[model samples]
Target chain A: MNSLFFYISEAVIGMKRSIVMMLISVITITISLFIFGVFLLISLNLNNIANSINSNLEIKVFLKETVTKTERSKFKQAILKLDHVKKVNYTSKNIAWKKFVKEYPHLNLDNLFENSPLPNSFTIGLDNNQYILNVVSNLKTFKSWVEKVSYGGIIAERMQKFSYYIKILGLILVIILTIATLFIVVNTIRLTIINRQNEINIMQLVGATNNFIKGPFIIEGILIGILGSLGAVIFLKIAYTFLIIKCNKILPYIPIVQNKLEINIILVSVILLGIILGILGALLSLSKALKRYSFNKVK
Target chain B: MIKLKNISKYYQSNSLILNNINLTINKGEFVYLVGPSGAGKSTILNLLLKIEEPTSGELFIDGVSLLRLKDSKIPYLRRNIGVIFQDFKLLPKRTVFENIAFALRFYNYSRSRIRRQVYQVLDLVGLTTKLDCYPTELSGGEQQRICIARAIVNNPQILLADEPTGSLDPETSWEIMTLLSKINMRDTTVIVATHNRGIVDDIRKRVISINKGAIARDEEQGSYNS
Candidate 1:
């Protein structure tokens, strides 16, 4: 306990001695973490939007005009039993025609045709978007009852491809940003170690053990990390909240992850990332410094 | 007790810092190592502190062989041996009290114990009045006294002083020598390496003179010269 206090005091003294350098390190860390937070927010929102669109996608199965009500009900029951099938709503030809006319008001259907051109169709909701291809293929196998099965095949394929690309791009960006942040942090810590060369020499000459000397330095590094993380979290919170308000005002239709739970998750992850990066930077620099100047050889 | 047998230190294939040095010093003895500049005086001190490994030889302090000692054990060995340099090597930012306290902190001493021990050493070195003064604020003699206080604060069994009074006036040099004698009286072996002929003559301690990296003369109650 006494040693811990001593280590902390020593670290504080070291920090005080190089206040400007320490501040620069902290600020650099803050900026890097903030950038990382921004990237995370963007990726999260893109994911949310993709998921919303996927959930709304529904498959339309058109039946033959001669199909009876009993056959249509049986078809609906079979679709409900299929994997990933959530809900099935049967639509009669009359109802389909009414919905079609309501969707396209310019077409005067009464003058164009006496009978409805639309066929009976069943609207199929799915538990998961990944099963869209499988369900579509399975519906095609029901050739006796289904006249046509369409789930916007081209659009669905394109959306899935786009979602995959977004994930890959987000991953690549995160890795690149994290590495850049680590490099900056390592360089900052190396500078701090260089500045304290004299102090470290004195400590070794006084017969301090390796751990005794390294404890304060490691603690100093951890403190820097925690402070940088705290700064990033505060900055990110304010910036994110402001961004949410501004985005809502400008683009009301854009879907974003604005819930408190999701924002908190992002905040926690950024703080954690900051801390890990800080520690790694400190360890790398400290080890390099230690190698350059062996504590066992004081002269 | 300290013993060195056939110690040889080489910087390169051709250059030797210390060559085939054999010596011993028992407990509670005051000894002076006298030699000219670059005559391996500092190298010997370095060897005692294990700051540099010998090209070849065995060194034993208090019956433990240092040749095979692990690097991790060096600090503990150093705690048993105090070292004083000509420059005083005091942390300029630390006060006299803190400078002395620095040695004890390595041993996991409680704050109260460290405070007590630091004050005790400060009083011994007659610097209790200047406990809070930084090294920059102290005179050369006072700074050297604080260095001595730091060296002895841990109650080390052996104290090695390498030209400790080299930077002081003759009077201040005498004062530092007298303090070292006082420390020696406490059953701590004292070894002072110096080029000062006057103090070496006046002290009349065991003097080992070295020339060309080897001991040239060893005398009892010897003067600076043969």
Candidate 2:
């Protein structure tokens, strides 16, 4: 006879025995994990925004459509010769049109142009991005061949710093929320133990082992934790997918996490953490209660 | 059989609960422990139950030295014994049937077997009609009967009743005593601790009287004062 099924059934019975308490526990975990996940999503998107802005910070020297290949090579070499210049990437007119089409497949450039009129451009990479303004100033000497010399302004740098602070602050808040979740879980389990103290004494009096006594409470913790995490995961999934679709329509260039697999992986990690903490909380509260409670009285 | 040899229990290292004691009760015996309040009648039961350690002695249950028993084996030890309390410790929320079925859980009995055994015990206690009644709904006598049904449902070899009739009237107490006597006739050893002099004298069983922390008298077929 497998006792596992029996014990698990006992845990289920216990859950139904006091549905209100169980609901309180589940709701607590759900709200906590949901808040934690919201912070996580915000931090991830902030990092994405910072990267997008940094990519735009590089100086772009758009060439006049009439420039020869030999002139392009000379211009690239001259740009590389500048202080703090790391490398130069050259994009042809046709390649730029293809890139634009890939980024916005819905927007047909053909409707706006008779042909691929996109200009060939050179992107300058610098060893230190703080020298972007200086490089942009140097490109002025070649105004005859250059259509435009543009780089992201001071706002890009500010956004990078802002996202960095958000990342650090998000980390601290996540740690605090995790601790709070554990404490709340532990307290909830402790309260359950107190409520069932009479039942526990009866169990002991009738020859139930310590493990048998602990089985249901541990199972309760796991169920509560899992439910909480799953609730948060489901909510995040629906809300995030909707937010991503809306953001894509309103702010098309903003890169938010829209990958289904990535989101599932994150949710799975959250559930695993919830389970581990649930078991820990159960064990901690149970040990204290069991030690305090002898056969019929609390010591 | 149960035995206590040179058993001494103390509290906080100085306040003695039970002084050097030696006692033994054979199988198929009905023994009464009678004394005044705080005479340590309950402490002896506590020691035998292993709820508290005998501070300085050897205690044995069914020929096994309880001192040498591993902590893990205590539950198994308890399985061989049943305890009935005065206050009728039944879960207020549970029906009489559920209360009896709870004791059979350690056996991992199937649902049919559990229901069958619970019915059998309830029949023996004569409360088969009140199976669905909760403790709160049952009369005091009926509640104690439910507790008895729960205790004996497992068919333990030894039964320990600590002031089992303390909360009952004389008639109900006699009725409970008659039921315990019926259980004892079926090869179960029954040890009852009580301060009720009327029940002790009328029952005419082996009586051990304690005063302060030591046994003051031990007699067979003893009345309350003999």
Candidate 3:
């Protein structure tokens, strides 16, 4: 126990000697993880927006204007009977005309025509928004002379492709940053080990074991890792908050909703990531340091 | 209490450092090892210190065979034997007090005890005022004295010093020799290895001479005749 205290004190002194190098390491790690954390936050928000769009998507089935009232009623009943159909609403020509005027109140549509020229349309809603593509394809087989069946699958497909690219880029960034962080940590700790090499040699001659010699260095690495991770977490929080506020203000056309639950989730994930990286960095450097130094052969 | 029977240590494929060495130093016995350069004077210290194993032989300390001991048990053996070197290998960054206190920490000494013992040893070596001085700030003689204080801080049963006065002048060397003699009188086996014929002739102690890695002379109250 007394030996452990001495070793810890020695580690602190060693770190103090290279305080500038230690700060550089911590800053590098924080920046790397911050980049990763910000990318994750953006991707998560994009995913949430895509989900909201999918839920509100509607499949529109236009009908032949020449159809009679009884045929339309039968067609509507058939759609409501379908297994996947959630709701069915038939828009008459008058109702469609009224909605068009409501959308363009200042356009003075009353001067254009005596009677409404808009055709009656059937707006379809599905039980599961994700299945709209398949649902629209099935609707095309209806016997009510379906003019056209259109769903938001095309836009959804494009968004999905974009999401794929974002994920790939995020992964690549993480790989590059992780390798760079490890390299930086390994080199810094290596310099530290070199500075104390003679002391280590003397300790070995005095019958210190491999564990005894390595304990201080490993502890130093761990401390650095922890501090770096904390810095990253702080940076992530600031970035996430800034993004949420800025995006909400700039992109008013697309409603941006910040889910408090998701923010909590990402915050927790970043904290855990910081801890894992800290421990990993320590363990990685220690393994390399031990290989270059053999306790029994110090003399 | 060290026993070496037919111990022979060789280097590479042909060169030998120690050949068929048989010797025993009883408990509380002080002995001086005198030899020219490359005569295995340090090799004998290295073997007893268990830094290297013998090529063929049996070595026992307190009836425990060092050659057969596991690596984990080596530290326990070393705790009983304090070692000092010719270079005064005190850590340059540490103070005189810290250097000595470091040895006691390994033995799990309490903080108060470590402080008291370190100061005691510093005073014994006449370095109480220089306790906070770094090795680089001290003279060659003072650094060597600090090394001696560090070696004896743990109160080991055996003290193995290799060419301790090799870098010191006549007066300082004699002072070191007197200190070792005083330490030996305290029932700690002190083995000093050196090539200083002047000190050998003056001390007239039990001297073991080595030539070409083999013992050539062993005499009580011996002087430098080679």
Candidate 4:
């Protein structure tokens, strides 16, 4: 156990002395993981925003001109009780007329019409945008006194399709970045291993097991990975803050700003990414160091 | 104890590197291997070290058949055999003290024990003053002495030196030979492979000569007659 600790300590010292290589490795890994983190953040928020918009796309159900106030109340209560329906809000003709007049008082509607021409309607919201299909199917059970049922069907479909594309694109980006990160880390560790060829031979001769010889290099690789991941996390936090400020300035009304919870998740994920990547780099380096070379026999 | 029986190592399906060789060296016996280049002098050392398997023979070092030994056991086998090379093979980046201390690390010796053994061996090689110096800063003879210090630090049962004085001058060569002789006197079986006729002739140790991948002569106290 003491020997293992000594070897690990020695390996760390060796990595420290070779600061240039260590820095380079850290920078490469950080950049790759930062890219991945940014994509993750954007993808998650995009999903949330998409779901919000879908739920708000409500159906407007128009009532018949001769329907009684009691009949309208019954219709409203029945729609609200439906499985998918979240809420039923009644918009009376007088309320609609008043809202129209408030927005456009100079349109001369008073002289053109004797009374409010619009029919009393129900604005029906579903629990989720996907529940629109179920709500539409249930509305078919309504009586002929219902004039029309209108919802943003085409718009909802388009937005859903767009969100799907974005998710797929994000997944592809993640895979590409992960692969690139592994490749860069592995190659960097391989160079370090090659540099220690003589040390490896001496260790082999000393009756050190393969694990004993590889443990240090593996630890070194992991350290490099951790440092790199840490760098990435720092970079990502700064980038996220800067991007949030920039987006707020550019499109303040778009609500693109992330909450504290979202930012915290990003931070945690980036740190975990660093640790995983570091372990991967160490594994790659260990396998290379584990390879035996014969000093007694000519290659 | 080391034993070789009908050991023949062939290459390219045409010629043997070591042909039907049979020999044994008891514990604490000093032996010298001398031959021309590519004459299987190094091959014999490699075989005994278990660095290469003999194609058609059985080898037993301390009653352990190296031929049937697992790959993982090779390092344990090597621990008992101290190897010295002409190139010194010292880690150039490390100080002389570190190089010697490293030999003990493989065996996981205690910290105080490593320090004592390293210092003792450095004193033995007369390199105690240059303990902090790296191999590149040391002279050729000094570097080779450090290699010797490293080999003996573990106090292995067998010391195998392959042309240890090949690059040194005649005076330095004699110094290294004398050091080997001294080490052998301490009861570790020593084997030196060399083409340096002057040093081999002067030593007058037991000699095994090889030519064209075969043992040409084996003498109890041979000279470089070939």
Instruction: Estimate the TM-score of every prediction.
Output: 0.83, 0.85, 0.83, 0.81
lDDT of 1 at A178: 71
How do the residues B38-84 of candidate 4 rate in per-residue lDDT, one tens digit apiece? 88888888887676778898999889999898888888888888889
Given candidate 1, what's the lDDT at residue A5? 92
For the second chain of model 3, what is the TM-score against the true structure's chain B? 0.97
Residues A1-299, candidate 4: write the lDDT tens digits.
Answer: 98769867976775776667777778877887787777777766666666666666888888889889888888878888888787888998988887777755545466566688888888887777677878876776786658777886766566667767877887797778777777777767666677887787777776777777777777777777778777878887888789878876675534464788877787788778776876687686666456546543521
Q: What DockQ do the predictions score, one after another? A: 0.41, 0.47, 0.46, 0.47
Looking at model 1, residue B123 earns an lDDT score of: 91
Mark the regions of model 2 whose C-alpha exceeds 4 Å error after superposition: A1-21, A42-60, A64-95, A113-118, A123-168, A295-299
Of candidates 4 and 2, the better by lDDT = 2
Under CAPRI classification, how is model 4 graded?
A: acceptable
lDDT of 4: 0.80
lDDT of 3 by residue, B85-199 (tens): 8898899888888888777666676889999999988888888999888899998889988988988887889999998899999999999988888888889999999988999
- Regions of model 1 farther than 4 Å from truth: A60-122, A126-167, A259-262, A295-299
In model 3 chain B, the worst 10-residue window by lDDT is: B101-110
- Model 3: C-alpha RMSD to truth? 5.1
In candidate 1, what fraction of native interface contacts survive? 0.46
Q: Kindly give the stretch of ten consecutive residues in candidate 4 chain B with the minimal lDDT sum.
A: B45-54
Off by over 4 Å in 3: A1-8, A50-75, A81-83, A89-131, A138-165, A252-299
What are the lDDT figures for the candidates, one per model? 0.83, 0.84, 0.80, 0.80
